[model samples]
Target: MRDTYIIGVGMTKFGRAGDWTLIDVLEYAAARALEDAGLGENVESVFVANMGAGILNRLSGLGSAMVDRLCLFPAAAETVENGPASGGSAVKIGAMAVGSGAVDTALVVGGEVMRAVTGWEATDFVATLTHPEAEYIYGVTLPALAGMFARLYMDKYGVTPEHLAMVAIKNHENAMKNPDAHIQQTVTMEGLLHRPEAVVNNPYVAEPLRMFDCCPVSDGAAAVVLCSREVAERSGKPLVRIAGFGQATDTHAVHEREDPTELAAVRTAAERAFAMAGRKPADVDVAELHDAFTILEIAQSEEAGFFERGTGHIALEKGETRPGGRLPINVSGGLKARGHPVGATGVAQVVEIARHLRGEAGERQIEKPRVGFTCNFGGFGNNVVCFVLEREG
Candidate 1:
């Protein structure tokens, strides 16, 4: 296979995009990425990662629509949906295309416009990701399932609500520095502990998880330009090589899993990625974990080998996952503070790591970063994808 590199990455500020349509967000990010890559007129093909355009915007064929809007009329285009992991999956496919000589350069875009509908409608739409008969039929939303997982994790690992709060506080602080982040306000322990009984007060969204613990319903898009090593070299920009990638899946229903607390898919994917990169967890200088909820960060950090099982909370307590700590995790604020716009989130994680490896993250930049890793989980860890990125010399 030929080597693949990310030449450019761009993303819209994620949040409630009041009036913008899904196609609008896609076009915005696609144009910015093409410009960043100095390939405004040379895109060969396009892969779009969109999960719920039809449900959210009453539109399909988003890939073709994006290509049209970008004025790449003749470019081949298709949409890829793999639950919330759609973004990372699209990037993986684009990288594969470039690496396998199917396409020299590909534009991969991940977008979702969720705010076009009411929050209840969006919530119901997202519920389709669960097992229809056994899960969703039983009123299991993402937060409810995640809360169940969090409860299990807490029971087994001795994690506390305060530990989860620390994760939120850290990410919100990090988001303050990221212009593209959705929720930028810094929350103190006291602020979270004390709020108006109506809004900011901790009312349980799902048992044991407050509204703040849940990722916001967001509408945004992110795009990345992938090219073969030859194309990257010609662009005259620092290269972020796709050193390793791994994807895995498990039972769709959460109850079918033998252990709810153990994300076996994440462990397997991370192991494969680390092996391909010929690097252990210690070799990673930074990371971006799918923190759809705060507990997920801790669970995934342990599963990815960054911290020992049941000790992820200890790592958080010591600030090992914060910027300027042992290993900075989620300097993009992760899905929690960064805003998980479904399909956009996974690819957005890749964008952040690419920027970090290129030393282009500005305020969130890690010191002398060399290797970076990203993990994107879908459907309560039913599907997991991990990538290891390295600076190409």
Candidate 2:
């Protein structure tokens, strides 16, 4: 297979955009990515990632709508949906098309207008990601399931609530440097510990998972332009090669898994990716794991081999996962502080990594970065996608 490279990446600020429509956000980001690629009308194909714009905004046909808005009306357009991993799946398809020489250039976009509905309504909409007959009907929301997973992880791994809060504080501190991050507040451990009222002020969305621990419902979009190596070289932009890609799925029902704390799919996917990239976890200079909840960062770090089994929480305590530490994870504030616009998150992670590898991450930039990794988990780790990126000399 031919190699694929990301030539350009762009994203809208990930937060509540009270005035921007879904189309507006998509158009804005897509156009910027095209300009960044130095291509005006050469896109050969388009893949869009959006889970439920119809349910969220009563709008459908987002794929074709986006193509038309970009004035690439003649190009073939397809939509990909895989719960919250939808964006990563789209990027995977786009890269595969370029790798197979089926398309010289492809544009992958992930956009969502989730804030169109009220908070409770958005919660219900996201809960539909659960199995309908077996889970959703039983009133299982994402937060509720995540709470169970967090509780199990703590019980099995000796992770505490303070560890979880530390994850939040760290990411919030990182988000302060990210212009596109959703939450930019620099939270202090003292403030978190001393303010008892503030602890419960945000209130518990689900037991063991408070509001601050949960990612906010966000409205945003992100896009990337992928091309074959030959085409990328011609564009004259700094390139980050797609070194590895792997995806795996587990039983849709969370209860069916042998261990609630262990994300089998994440382990499988990361192993495949690391093998493909011919690199170990230590080789990764930076990473962006799916931190929809703070506990997920800890669970995923261990599952992805960034830390030894049951030692991820300790890694956090040692500051190994922070910037200027052993390995920086989620310098873009992550889903927790960066805002998780479900469908848009996976692609956004790629965009951030691409920036880091290209040395264009600005304040969040890592020193002498060579390799970056991203993990996108869907529906309580039932579906997981991992991408390994390397800087091209």
Candidate 3:
């Protein structure tokens, strides 16, 4: 495969994009990325990632719409949907197009306008990712599933509510530094767990997973410009390449997995990515884990090989996962604070790491990060995509 590098990255602030249509948000991010790349309307291919446009927005043909909006006439355009992992899948396709000599320049944009519906409606929309017969028909939602997973993990790993609170507090602090993050307010352990009014302030969403633990429903978009080595070198941007990527899937139903607590897809995907990148967890400078729920941060940290199994929360207790620590996970505040615009998230993860590698991340930047990793979890870990990105000089 030919070498591929990201030339530009852009994203809208993750929050309520009150008046913007889904196409509007997607166009905004795409324009910014193209402008950042200085590519004009030279894109040869376009990949738009969206999960709920058909269901939530009553719209379809996103890729064609984006091409028309961007005026990239005749560019190969397609929409990719893989539940919440749609962005990662789109990026993967874009990279493959460039890497396989199919296209020199590819544009990938992912966005979702979920808040247009009521909160409950949005929840039901997202719950459609679960198994239709075994999970969805039984009224299973992502938060409910995460709560059960958290309960099981806590019992097995000795992770207490305090650890979960720690994840929320830390990510909230990180989000404060990210202008694009959805929730700008900071959270405190006492306010979330210990205070008398904690119950009212941060009520339970699903058992063992409180309001603070879950990412807010948000509307946003993120985009990246990928190109071959020659194009990247000529563009005069820092060379941040897609070093390697891996994808894996487990059973559709959570209970069908041999070990429900073990995110086998996450483990396998990360392993394949790291092997392809010729690096290990210790070599990673910064990382992003899908933190739809706070416990997921702890669980993914372990599964991604950042910490030993069942020891991620212990590492969190040691301040190892925070900024300035050994490894800064989710310095962009993760989904917990960054806002999970489903389709936008995976691309947003890449955008964050690329900015860090380019030394462009503002207050939340890591110190000279060389290698970065991202884990985009889909369908309760049944489908997963992992990417290993590196800075080349």
In candidate 2, the residue pairs with backbone N, CA or C atoms under 3 Å apart (3 or more residues apart, or in different chains) clash, namely none
lDDT of 2 at 225: 95
Give one digit per residue, the lDDT tens place, for model 3 in 4-112. Answer: 9999899999999899999999999999999999974579999999999999899999999999998999899999999999999999999999999999999999999
TM-score, per-candidate, Cα-based: 0.97, 0.98, 0.99
> Top model by TM-score, which number?
3
For model 1, what is the C-alpha lDDT against the true structure?
Answer: 0.89
Residue 330, candidate 2: alpha-carbon lDDT: 92
Best by lDDT: 3
Regions of candidate 2 where Cα sits further than 4 Å from its true position: none
In the range 1-393, model 2's lDDT, one tens digit per residue, is 788999989999999878999889888888888889987456999988998887987777887888899888688898888889999999999989999999899999998889899998999998998989989998899999999988888988898878988999999999999999988888766566457776666567777877777888898999999998888888888879999998999998999988777899999999988898888889999999998888899989999999998999999999999999998999999999888888899999999999999999998899979999999998888889999999988
Error of 3 at 377 (Å): 0.5
